[model samples]
Target: MRAVTVLGLEGSANKVGAGLVRDGQVLSNPRFLPGQTARHHRGCVLAVLREALQEAGLEPADVDCVAYTKGPGMGAPLVTVAVVARTLAQLWNKPLLGVNHCVGHIEMGRLITGAQNPTVLYVSGGNTQVIAYSEHRYRIFGETIDIAVGNCLDRFARVLKISNDPSPGYNIEQMAKKGQKLVELPYTVKGMDVSFSGILSHIEEVAHKMLASGECTPEDLCFSLQETLFAMLVEITERAMAHCGSQEALIVGGVGCNMRLQEMMRIMCAERGAKLFATDERFCIDNGAMIAQAGWEMFRTGQVTQLEDSWITQRYRTDEVEVTWRD
Candidate 1:
């Protein structure tokens, strides 16, 4: 059987990455420079697609499938890339696959790390879900009943006008590195799920009050925010491990790039004698490689989405995926 090759596009947010995958191996995975204000994501997506095509030594016509991020992203950016993807699908008359943004992260972790079965901790601006396979579907053991983890971080950064110049997360992480104290913010972890909206407001309020009274600096606030959020994520991941009876864990999504969160997760996993898997910058953030890899697997499983099938959701639950795996 001839191997199927796919050209993947990702424009879920500021970073637009493209890749070429054949039989689940990425021949090329490249991310365009992320946009700061969200206006630049469209052009970045186009440029990255061309970049990936050249890197793969293939043209648009070389692809057997065109896969793109379906939802759980900025509307303008997703629409921009979706239009390009759909047009390519129509022009090439090849199968067009739309992959879920969150699932792509988990699938990419599995691809890069070679983990058989592990709990997934997916944290990003648009999502914060802990997933495990059970019965006939992916069970969402823990999640944000409201705002997401990364979104909380971003919102706090925006409140202070912290430079989005180099990427908001990086800026926050930098500030957090300079931080010296743990301010002890609220950590609301009830059962397996968690909440961040209150934490976000609490941090902002504390920062503003302190700044006004000359009691604290932005770096202090930043450090406190990171501590609060990372603790919340670590709490959920540990609880999920106990809930799912799985020690092996995979941390996926953009927020997984944070050194602070990764460190906490690694230490937590070590305590339990469990292995923790994390992709570097490549698979950690939104990338086309994950989409291509996921598309190939779903393709084999006959999980293709129609052009008129439409987008599922931006806030769709991770547990909704019907499992075809055996325990």
Candidate 2:
């Protein structure tokens, strides 16, 4: 049998990405995200697609299927990429697969880290969930009740006027290292679920006052925020692992790039004699290669999205997709 090659498109939020994957190997992944708008994605998607194909040194005919992120993201950007994917699928006369964005992150993390059935922590700007696979689906063990942890960090960064060059969360992580004091912040973890909106509100309210009064520096606030939020995430994740009796823990999504978060999680895992699995920014952040990888699994398992059923879903949940590719 020939290797199943897939072309993947991702524009769920700000980033517009294109990538190619053949079987389990990633060929090329190019991304561009200057702004969060359909117009920006529309303008740069084709260029990114061309760049991915060129970098991969493959023609359109080399691909066997077209895959794109179908939901759980910004509406306009998702629709824009879905249109591109649909058009490409029709143009190339190939099958189309619509992948769940969260599943893409989980699948890619598993593929990269070789983590077998690890409990997953999926954290990003728009989502935060503690998940595990069971009964032919990825089940959500815990999740954010309001805004996500990444969003909390980004909003705090904005309050500090931090540069979003790489990402707000990244800048916060860097600043947090120089922090001398850890200011008190609300730690809200209820059962398996966590809440960040109240913490965000509390921090935002005091940040300016603390800075003005020399009570705490921006670095201190960032440190406190990171510690508070990551502790909540780690708490819930550990609970999920204990509940599932899982011995492996995996972290995925954009916020998973934070070394501090990983460090905290590692400590928690080590205490329980469980291994930790994670990826660098290349695979952690939203990228097309992840979508392609998830799509490859689906396509190989005889899953395809008909043209009429290719509509984008902004609120697609993590546990919705059936894990046909996995036993």
List TM-scores for all candidates, in order.
Answer: 0.91, 0.99
TM-score, prediction 2 = 0.99
lDDT of 1 by residue, 1-327 (tens): 888888878887777788888986888999876536256665576677888888989886788888888877777778777888888889989888887777778878988998768899998878898988778666788889889888888898888998877678889999989988677789898888888999988887778788888777788888988888888888888888987789798889888889888899999999999999887777887788888887777776666668897453554555666544334
Model 2 per-residue lDDT tens digits across residues 1-327? 989999889999989899899989999988987564799999999999999999999999999999999999999999999999999999999999999999999999998999999999999999999999999999999999999889989998898999997789999999999998989888899889999999999988998999999999999998999999999999999999999999999999999999999999999999999999999999998999999999999999999999999999999999999999999
The clash tally of candidate 1 reads 0
Predicted model with the maximum lDDT = 2
| Candidate lDDT (C-alpha), each | 0.81, 0.94
Candidate 1 C-alpha error for residue 283, in Å: 1.7
What is the C-alpha local distance difference test score of candidate 1? Answer: 0.81
